[model samples]
Target: DFPPLLISLGDLRRGFVFHEVKQVLITDEDIFKRYRERRQRWVGEEEKKIERWTELRGGDYVVHIDHGIGKFSGIKTLKLQGRKCDYFQVNYKGTDRLYIPLDQLDRLHKYMGDSDHPPPIYSLEGGQWRLTKRRVRKAARDLASSLLRLYSIRKVIPGYHFSLDTDWQLEFEASFPYQETPDQLRATHEVKQDMENPSPMDRLVCGDAGYGKTEVAMRAAFKVVMDNKQVAMLVPTTILAEQHHRTFRERIAAYPIRIEMLSRFQGLKEQKDIVTSLKNGGVDIVIGTHRLIQKDIEFKDLGLVIIDEEQRFGVIQKKKLRELRSSVDVLTLSATPIPRSLYMSLMGVRSMSMIVTPPKERLNVETQVAEYNEE
Candidate 1:
C-alpha cells in the first residue's frame, strides 16, 4: 500500500463496489504540484478574442461611414494624379456612385440589414442613420458592461477540472460513423479544451438540423464521465428527451458509462430509482425534460448541463435554469438561433460556434432563374 487511495462509499447492491477516479492523488511533491496546477488554472485574453476574416463578394451590400447603405460593384483600376491605384466602386441610390481608394478600406463594412423588405435608404444629408447608430452603440455598451461583471464573478469560483482525453476517448472518436467536418472538429476541440480547464464553460453551438450538433454534445458528455462527474441534458419536449437518451446509450454501449432518462413516459418507480441513483453518484448522465429542474432532484456532482431547443423554454423555466447557471459548465444547441442568443455571445457572456458549411456528400442543387409567370 505504498500509494494511498482517496476512497468513498460505493454501491451496496453488488456487495462491494469501488469506483476509481481517473485522476489519482499522490504524495510525491512533483506529482501533487502538477495536479494542483491543473486544478486551478485560467484562460488568457488572447484566446477570448473572436477571429474576423470575413470575405466580401460582388453584388453584396455594404455600409460606408459617410454614405448610407449601398451595394458593392467590385474593384476598378483608376489613374489619379498621374498614379495608378485600385478603387472599390460603390453604387448608391439615384445613380450616385462613390469610389473609395484601397488604402481607405476601413471606412466600409458589410451591411447586415433586411433585403426582401429593406429599410428606406436615407439621404447623406439626413441624420436618420446616425440616430440609429447612436442607439445601437449605447445598447452594445450596456451589454458589454453586464457581461464584464459576470466574468469577474465566475473567475474566483472553482469548477470540476477534468483531466485531458485518454486513448479510450481517441478510440471512441475514431469509431464515429461519418467523417467530421472541419467546423465540427473545431467545435469539439474547443469544448474539450474548456472541459480540461479549471473555470466553468459557457458555450453555444448553432447550426441547422442534422449538422452533428448532437455529436459535439456526446463527446463532451463522454469526457466528463471519464472524469467521474455526472452530465445533465435538458430538453423542452419529452419526445426529444427520449430520443437523446436512446442516442447517448447507443454511442457509449462499448463503455461502462451508466446512462438514464427522466420523462413522463417512465413510471413513477423508474423515475424514483433514477433520481436516487443520480443523487448517490451512481449515474453518469441523465437526459430529461424540464422536470429535471424541480426541487427534489439532486446530483452528487454535475459537471456539465446541455440544453437542446433552448428557445422553447418559458420565462419561469428560464428563471430556474438561471439558478443552476452559477459555477456550472453549460452547453446550448440551437438551429435558427434567436437574436437574443447571438447577442449574448457578441457581448462576451457566452462563446459561440457556427456550422454553416454542409457535408461534402450533400447534393448540389441547380437553379435556373426565369421571369415569373402565373401558370
Candidate 2:
C-alpha cells in the first residue's frame, strides 16, 4: 500500500489532496459573487413557499390552529431569560389573550370563516372555539366547492413558462418618479415569480386608490411583454383605459412593445383592426374597457390579464372571466381592499397580495373654512 501525500499547486490556499497530486484553483470574485447572489435569491424563494401566510394587521381576525379564532393585537416585547424578545399578541373572546412566540407564526393564518361575516368571537372558556371552528369549517367546506374547481384546474393546466426579467424591466421600474413601497415590491416580485412558473397565476392585489398598485401591475405587465407575450389590461371605465394606455406607453417607451387602446374612443373599424392585430400577434399590450370581455375579442398569445377595479365588473363579465381564470395568468387590482365577501368566494382558491401601506410622498390639499355667524 502507498502512503498518502499532500501537495499545493496554485495561488489559492484551498487545495485538493491526493496520494502525491494536489491542485488549487482560485475563484474569480465577480463570478463567485454573482453565483452567491443567485443562490441566495433561489433560497429565499424556496423559503417563501414553505408557509405562505399574509401579514396580519391589528384587529384583523385570524385563526390559531389550536385556539381557533382571535383578533391580532400586535407584537409585544417581553423579557425572558434576561433577554428581550418579541411575541405576537392575540386577543380572543371574553378578555382572553394568547401570546405566541414569533417563531410559531406558521400555526396562524388570516381567518376566512363564514360567508359575508365571520363567526362571533369565540370565548376562551367552555371550549367554545372548538365548536366555532367546526361550524366555520363546515361553512368553508360548502363554499370551498365552488372555489376548488378553479384550484384544481390551476394545478394541472400549464401556462407559458416565461423567462426571467430583462435589463429593460430594471430600467423601466427605475424610471418611476416615486419610490416603490415595500408592499408594492413584494407584490411585483410575486407576480414576476408567478409568471416565470409553469402553473397559471391567479393573484388578487388589494390596495387603496393612491397606493402604488398600478405601478406593481405595470411592472408585471412589462415583464410579461418582455418575454414576447401579449398583455391585456381591463379597466372599468374608458377614462381609466386611456390613462393606463398612456402610462404604459410612457414607462415602457424604451422597449419595443406596441401599446394600443380599445374603448368607446376608438371607432368600430379601429376596434376591429385592433382585434385583428391582437389575434395576429402584432400588438404587445392592449388596454381596454369591459368590452374587452366581449365574445368578439381574442388574443394570439395572451400570457397575462390585468383587471383594474375588478368589483366594477358585472355578473356576465365575471362569468366570462371565470373561464379564463384557469388558462391565463390573471392579476386583479382594486382601490379598496378585498372585502370579506370576495375573499370568502375565492378562499382556498387563489393567492392574494395586499398593499395597505400608503405611498411615501404626496401633495397636500389646501382647505378653507368660513364662519357663518351673521347668517
lDDT of 1 by residue, 1-375 (tens): 433655443211122233564454334433345434422332231222212213557777777765757777888888766777778888777677788876666557776666797645545555666787678779778756655666666777876788989888889999998889998999899888887788888888998877789999999999888888999999999989989999999999999999999987789999999999999999999999988998889999998999898889986776576556667898889986557678878776678988776666866556799999999
Which pairs of residues collide in model 2?
A: none
Best by lDDT: 1
In candidate 1, which residue ranges exceed 4 Å CA deviation? 1-151, 362-375
The TM-scores of all predictions, comma-separated, are 0.58, 0.57
Off by over 4 Å in 2: 1-146, 337-348, 364-375
Q: What is the C-alpha lDDT profile of model 2 across 1-375, one tens digit per residue?
A: 424533323224222434454533344533355345423433332121215324667788877766767888998988866778878888988789888877777657776656677667666678876677579769768546745787688788788898877888788888898887899889898888888899998888887777788899888888888888889999889989988889888878877889999986789899989999999999999999877888888898999999888778776776677677878999988766346435643674567788888887755445689887886
Give the local distance difference test score of model 2: 0.77
RMSD of each: 24.4, 19.2
Q: For residue 237, give model 2's deviation from the true position in Å.
A: 1.0
**Model 2 TM-score?**
0.57
